[model samples]
Target chain A: MSKYLLNKFLYTVDRDPELVERYREDPRGTVAWWEAERANQLLNCHTGEASTWLAFDDPEREALVAHDYVKLFELGAHPFLTLTLFIAAFERDHAEPLGFQKEYALRLQHFSLPYPDIAT
Target chain B: MAELAAVIASTHHPFYYRASTARGEDRPPFADEWVRKITAFRETLTRANPDVLVMVGSDHFHQLWLDNMPQFLIGKAPVYDANWYNEEREFGLPRMVLKGQEDLSGYLLREGLDAGFDLAFSNELRIDHSITCPIITLRPEADLPIVPVYTNIFAPPLPQPKRFVQLGRTIRELIESWPSDQRVAVIGTGHLSLELGGPRQFGPHGPDPEFDQRAVEWIANGDLEGCLSEVTLDSLHAPGNATHGFMDFMLMMGVAGEGAKADYVDTLDLFHTMEAYFTWYPSGGPGLSEERACEPRSEGKGESA
Candidate 1:
């Protein structure tokens, strides 16, 4: 499922102010760019030593492009990463405190126990 | 030999920094009560008069990533840079730099590994909110040298609940055996039935109040047998998706010893989660006189926020 790659994308982008804005402004473009350029680059290694086999599957790419956290959750992408990055990307849209978080919870109320496995 | 001054456990809420510091209309209604409870909680550590702090917390995908995740790690750096860009963006936590107790870190790593816990060591670790939140609440002056111990409570394939307790026990033993006269306080932070990034996120209370009630009792009473019998890696999910963080508290329970009731206990029911604080005086609370040590334990409970 390459859930690890999905998390790596969220983790890398969420830590950088420029990337957060870029992903927020253009999810499709950012997802495409990240999958092509950043996916195979080992985080702690030099660019020249980047691995060649890491790539997101079609469903994962579409979910990121769509900014669909619910789909990300269903796909077993780590929920904490998705939530933190999404909050950073979108919490500004709502004026009230915790408004976006409450809405985020309501959207996923369908999920019951044994929620999707997040193990990599 | 070093004295095990105090063993403390708490819930590390990142929102507290922003909530407590917000001014005028920006401040939430719960700020005043939270501050009061934190001030009292801070006293428990201060009264112990510790020379060093052993901070126990979990990293939230900040420095440790999935590719090379360690189950348990100790920071051996001479200094650690605290907080992160995301924490600043979300929680308004100020960036801090704290001195490290490298001698204690070295002792724990060497002894912990020899004691059968394969602990990873970091020479240049940047701690996240899990470690920093307690510092903000308990030791805002940030004067004491610290040894940061990071546990893997976030990632899956985690160590079993018993292992965390065992590690805690080993840490306590190692500290007491260290050939130094310094008094050390071990502080750890974890959650009570927390659910993040799921259907139950941001609820009025923790995702499971019944579980929180029982968990608090287990900790306050130091009922490790009761805690371990009921808690397992798989079972933690029922309380909340993120409830596994409670294992850190179990580790603290190990440090406190079996059947060792806490000397200080407090709780505050804030939105989304419960805030719990606990402290134990292994050597009868260091700075106090003999009569004061025998006095009744102090307890505080806050009204619902």
Candidate 2:
């Protein structure tokens, strides 16, 4: 469930600038806030192993986590997250039925979420 | 003065392990061939026996994050700690200590910054598969000292192609100026056409072999301008933003210069990967003059054995 927790954490961080700012200000407290909101999910993801939960004491550590988030979610470094780029970055496809665009649209359909009407 | 021994560019995709360890159904026709070819390339590297190997590669968001991403970085540790971060664990590369050349790191930092490149210095930065993949395959011993030059191609605002070329030129200048008699080799890890993480990265649209082949031929033939002109920022970013590895090739070309000759070239049809080795000699050959070599060179030319 580290995957799910990571996805949810990244999903929220990708959308909420305020949360990102909060994470920037205090990473441990931000994790505490996230735990307060989704403690059960985090707990489920936690196995009897070294915690993958974001824990960084210094700005450099926070920046390290932030960098991974930007690469995976914001920068389209991961696959499913690449579609999120269409809405987030507004980068258009060069050809017909844009790949990221189409996948994002279909994913919204699958989740029964409203189409974002992203203007690429 | 330090001599430019070799400039080898190869594909460093993490899936290389999967391809290498495929048992039955997953094995592509080119997998064994890829292994054979890389083995041969490593043989050549061993013979070259470079005292210090300078690796030019890009970050994978594993080491550098978004909050404080530097456009360029140089590792300053005497021994690099091979800490496999996320996604790199699959490679199972040892968490061992590898030698690093701090002198070259400091020189590159000072000169790179003075040349208008925003260079970041790190003594404890961990390397990702973009580098380790090639090191594990081509230079398996991991005994040689290395200086890693990293650029941010995994995200947007990737340093321009011309800028990478200039960065290569700067490396060449530094190597030429070094008072030590180090026989230096440069490995520009990563290459042509890959579409990982995006939907189009797999299945029917996964890899564009046609593009890979064409790009490989251009590089092997030392067509630097052709590569620079055609492999534009837009072209590389096509097919799921995967071809960013092309920056490594451009940087290699810049370091090798016009005079270097392409000695060996291999293009894997399956992974859409291309591998080429170029050598620059002290004497005359087809490569650029010392003056011309400094003028934004490509990385695919050098002496032929």
Candidate 3:
């Protein structure tokens, strides 16, 4: 309903209850993210009934919209826009980043279009 | 009646954002008015109620690169969000998808064979902006389901123009073959005419309108394949990354099965080595629903005559 810059923008951090607890404890690893203005805005935006998450591909090309993991990214101030492939970060892989947000992986159904040299 | 709704392509060399257009030229990130327009369009696409999205675009480091990547891949997910980049943090600002993915791998294999594409299938992949931007532009909130195909526009050993065209037809085949009676959209994401790091090469600006117009004409005419056939990969790159992986669009056209509607919205001179155009293949003229319940498009037999 509201307009975001290019795509739906949301930040997230680790979703596992324990990992989030750890992130909250370690002030250095994620201090900048904690201070991001939009992060607080997103937290205020969520009403539980509706919330968007980070959309990414599975190991095999499936898509996932695990909102909680997205919450992790949003919590950390890293907003990325991607398509069918899994979303990655400059500093980390999709799995290891954000405290292993594995449960959030979304696997969507779609055919693979063939071209060339595009080894996975 | 399988019809192509839209085409989404990917390209390297940032053109849209002047601050980030040049290599190592880190300017502040932007989420300007133009960005808002694109986001609005995504809402319109979702209102159409399409089932399955056929995404044809390139890969940066998300899928494949010199170090690691895939030639061709597909996505299977019930739900996924499209993302926008935050240069400040170098990470994805996640969005959410309500529902998607209908397990169409078999259909892809079938049509891919008939169309002469050597596909590299995968059940696991994380798509990048090349594939995602187009999808988000059409369906911003990630409410729509999709079937994505990757193109090696970024890496070496990419598919030729004609080959890409055949890939499009295969999409037609897969969509038509499916029996769920779902309406579908095809997104080809790429620039009409891009010069990559355009601000650096041509100054901080967009490509020459003449060049972009010619390229746009080709796309609208469904003659992108012919356009590519006329030029060598080197010349294509002169305009920018738009041309780098442009052949991928030809493949998208094949899937859309001909006829790019005349409506090209908001042709902007966003930056040098890059320009953006929004157009679609009308599933069935005005007043007709987006559903493609007819027969698969008649294959052109070859990418082009």
- For all predictions, the C-alpha RMSD in Å is 2.6, 10.9, 15.7
Using all chains and alpha carbons, the TM-scores for the candidates as numbered come to: 0.97, 0.68, 0.56
Q: Which of the two candidates, 2 or 3, achieves a greater DockQ against the reference?
A: 2
Instruction: Kindly list the per-residue Cα lDDT of model 2 for residues A1-120, writing each as its tens digit.
Output: 133344445445544546645655665677667755642343324544334454323332342244333333322234333333223333233344245444543333322111111111
**Candidate 2 lDDT by residue in tens digits, B1-305:** 88776777776766666667777976756679768766766765665668998888877645565546788889999877764533333333456567899988888788778878778888887776777777877787888889988887765657778788788878888888877888888888766776544433433423566676666666565567777787766667553346777777878777877534565555444432344443333333234344333421223332222
Candidate 3 residue-wise lDDT, B168-259, digit = tens? 77676667666566676777675555432112223345444566666555665566545756656556655543355666655655654455
- Please say which candidate is ahead in TM-score: 2 or 3: 2
Off by over 4 Å in 3: A1-120, B1-36, B67-69, B77-92, B95-100, B195-202, B257-261, B285-305
Candidate 3 structure, TM-score to reference: 0.56
DockQ of each: 0.93, 0.10, 0.02
Q: Give me the runs in candidate 1 sitting further than 4 Å from their true place.
A: B286-305
Question: lDDT at A120 for candidate 2?
Answer: 11
Best by lDDT: 1
Deviation from native of the Cα of residue B68 in model 3, angstroms? 5.4
Error of 2 at B87 (Å): 3.2
